[model samples]
Target: MNEFELIQNIFKASVMANTQGRKDILLGIGDDCAQVQVPQGQSLVFSMDTLVEGRHFPFDADPVDIGYRAVATCVSDLAAMGAKPAFFTLGLTIPKSDPQWLAGLAQGMAELAEPIGLTLLGGDTTKGPLTLTLQVHGYVEVRQTPLRSNAKVGDDVYVTGLLGDAAAAVPIVTGEVLVSNERLDYFYDRYWRPTPRLIVGMALKRVVNAMMDISDGLAQDIQHILKASNVGARLEADRVPISAELRQWQPESALSLALTGGDDYELCFTASKEQASEIQLITQTLSLPCTKVGEVASEGFSIEGYDGDISGWQHF
Candidate 1:
């Protein structure tokens, strides 16, 4: 298919990509450029992420997972800033115009977009090796958005949801792991389809002193917070949450994954001691597992009981 045909047929024509009659979108696909309206009294939040075959995922990974993951990761950034998902544009490159793959990608993205009320704005398509880039835009109350640098000393460090499942899934995806069962399926799904903590982040924005999502890994990602806030941290290794499935699948390696494994897509935040009860109430009310793992300190970073080798995910 030609470029225009691919855009109209695979993307613009898909029900998932078109948000019919959306008042906020002045123009979407089929236009020279997409246009949108920022709501009054709200600040716009935007993030872009690129995924390349072999670098970001296995070359033969499911196309649907690829589509879903691209959007999910972009929205995760919005969640970190405590913003609502609004609209997104896609820049997709493929070696050839494959209808089956495009259909699968559209289906996967639509399933995710429909639930979150995300509208596909517009973007570019090119003939090249497979790579996907998505730019997500959202909004939050003016001047209330959280940042990684806002962590304060005396703040209790917390994380929403378990960690390390996605990191462990890497070996499975690469065929390095021999195990197969519920544990394998769970990890595989976690890596492919991460649950962005949007609601939890939006709820905790006004309450937390600092906030960020766990994309690179707990140890490395948390350093961004510490350096930005100009403070240190001492995390209780025992308090770090690990899933039972991961523990059973990798008894010796699970702890390290939970600590340094990337791709959890969960939110890590800090609040003062006085707000601990309120934090608990918020998580409990939402039925989301929020764990207190450490506190912001005035010195250097340390995770008690973990002194072994662990590093963050790096493109280099």
Candidate 2:
């Protein structure tokens, strides 16, 4: 089939199949640029992420998982900003049209979108090496959006849920580790499907001074908060939560992996000492486990067991 016909048959149908409640989408597919309307008194918070085969995921990875991860990662950004997810646009580049692959991908994306009230508005398809990009939009009350720069020196550092499982899962997913079926499934799910802490972020909006989702390890993500807030931190190694699965595998490296390895997608936030009691109450109400791992400081970032040095993921 020709390129245009291929897109019409595969891409166009894929776009139309996922139905979401998006009244403001004035124009969607078949337009040069999709148009959307923003309601008054609400500010838009948008983010985009690109995932390339081999770099972001294994070349042989399931297309469905790839699609789910692409959407989840981008939506996590919205969650960090304490925004209500609205809609999204996708940009897919592939070498050829594959109906089975596209169907699986659409199914995965629909699974995530349906749960979170997100709608797929529009996107473009092109011929290239496999790549997926998602641009997500969300809404926040005017002047009420959280930012990374708002953290204060005396604020307590916190993270939701356990860490390190996703990092530890990598080797197993790539077949570097031979684990039992149960352990294998656990690790694979942790790596492939991350639950973005959207509800927690929304509830903690006014309470959290600064917040971010841990995409590139706790240590590295915290650095972004530190730099933006013009402060340092002292993270306690023992206080950082590590999963039982991760602890069982490499107890010695548990702290290191939790602090340095990536793909946790949990919220790292800061609240004042006075707000600690309230923070506890909120977490309990939401049933989301949160830990006070450290406190923001004046000078530089340091982890308790790391001898006053910070060791985390480095892209370079």
Candidate 3:
């Protein structure tokens, strides 16, 4: 199909699916740009992420997984700010019009959006190297938005859920791992479909002094918080959680991956020692697992139980 036809068929349909029940959406697809209404007394939070084939995923990766990951990555940003997802726009660039590929991609994105209450408002389509960009917007109560700069010395650093599974799954997705079907499925799912800690973020609002999602590995993400808060940390390497799947493969490597491999969309935040009981109670009520991995300090960042300097994923 030609570019215009592809837009009318696949792009339009996806937009329609995304904008359904979105009362705040004033304008959607088939327009120069989409429009939305921002309610008063609420602050709008926006984040965008782009995924390119080969660079972000395998060249022959499943489109559905690609779509889901693209949206989840952006939603994670909202979660970090303790905001409720409102709507999103998708920009897709592809070399050709492939109906099957587009359908899978739309389905993947819709699956995540349906449960998260995210509406796809609008986006643009073009011919180029295959890439998917999602811009998500959320809202938080006035003056209640979580920031990474609020952490104070003596605050307890906490993380939710297991880490490093996504990074471990990367090799499985790229055919680097030779394992049983069960193990392969475990890793592949972790890498492709990550659960953003939206509920945790929302519940921690006002309680957490600083927060961010662990996308670029825990070590690196923690540094972001430390720098913003103008404080250092002493992370207990033994306190980092590693999944059973990862442990089975290489017990020693699990900690390294969990700390430095990246791609885990878990929530990491700082709360005062006085707030620890309250945070624990909240996690129990929500049925989410959380662990105190470190303590905020007035000095430099360092991790216990590991030799030399701390290491994590680097974009460069």
Candidate 4:
């Protein structure tokens, strides 16, 4: 089909299904330029991410999972900022317009975005390598949104959910490893369908002094908070949470993956020790595990219980 036909039949239809209650979206698909109404007393927040074939996903990966991941990972930025998801615009580049593949992608995007009430505002489609760029928009209270630059010394560092699973799944995704069906499913979900931790993030906005998502492994990502806030950290290496699935599969490397492996999409945040109880209460209400992995320090960064080179996903 042609570009207009492809969008009208597939992408536009997907947007319509997800845009029902999105009053914030003034003008969505079919417009020359989409318009949105930012909530009063709140600031607009946005982030864009690009996923390319072979780099972001395997060439043989299912388009459904790819689409879902494109939305989930990008929306993680909103969660990191403690923002409520609003709408997104997509920029699609493909070598060819395959109707079936495009349909699966649309279906997958809707599956994840519908429940969250995130709608597609608008975007562009072009011919090129297989790549997808999603720019997510959200809203946060002007003064309440947490930032990386606000962490303070003596604040406790915490992360939501277990880590290392997605990093471990990389090998499997690349056909470099094989495992049982159950384990395969777990790792695949971890890699391809990460939860954005939005509820936890919004709840912790007041509780945490600083907040950011762990896209590039805890070791590398935590340092970002430190640098941005002009502080140092002392991480209890053993405290970094690792999934049972990953520990059982790679006991020797589980810790490393938790520390240096990327794509976990979990939130790494900091809060005053006095707020520990409140943090616990909030996470408990959500039934999500939030673990204390470290504490802010006066000067330099260090990881207790292990001495190794600290590195993460290198985009370069």
> lDDT at 260 for candidate 1?
83
Better of 2 and 3 by lDDT: 3
Per-residue lDDT of candidate 3, residues 204-259 (tens digit): 98799999999888888999889988899999999988887899987877888898
C-alpha TM-scores of all predictions? 0.96, 0.94, 0.96, 0.98
Could you arrange the candidates by TM-score from highest to lowest?
4, 1, 3, 2
The total number of steric clashes, by the backbone 3 Å criterion, in model 1 comes to 0
Q: CA shift at 135, candidate 2, in angstroms?
A: 1.1
Question: In order, how many clashes per candidate?
Answer: 0, 0, 1, 0
**Taking the tens digit of each residue's C-alpha lDDT, what string does model 2 give over 1-316?**
7766665555445535544456666777666877878777888999999888877777878878887888888899999999998888888898888878887887788778767887777777888999888999998898778799999989999999999888888888777789999999899999999988889899899899999999989988999999999999998989999998889978888788898888889999999999999889989999999999999999688888754224565555
Cα lDDT of model 2 overall? 0.85
Which segments of model 4 are wrong by more than 4 Å? none
At residue 240, give the lDDT of candidate 3: 89
Q: Rate the local accuracy (lDDT) of all candidates.
A: 0.86, 0.85, 0.86, 0.90
* Candidate No. with top lDDT: 4
Candidate 2: the clashing residue pairs are none
Q: Score candidate 3 by lDDT.
A: 0.86
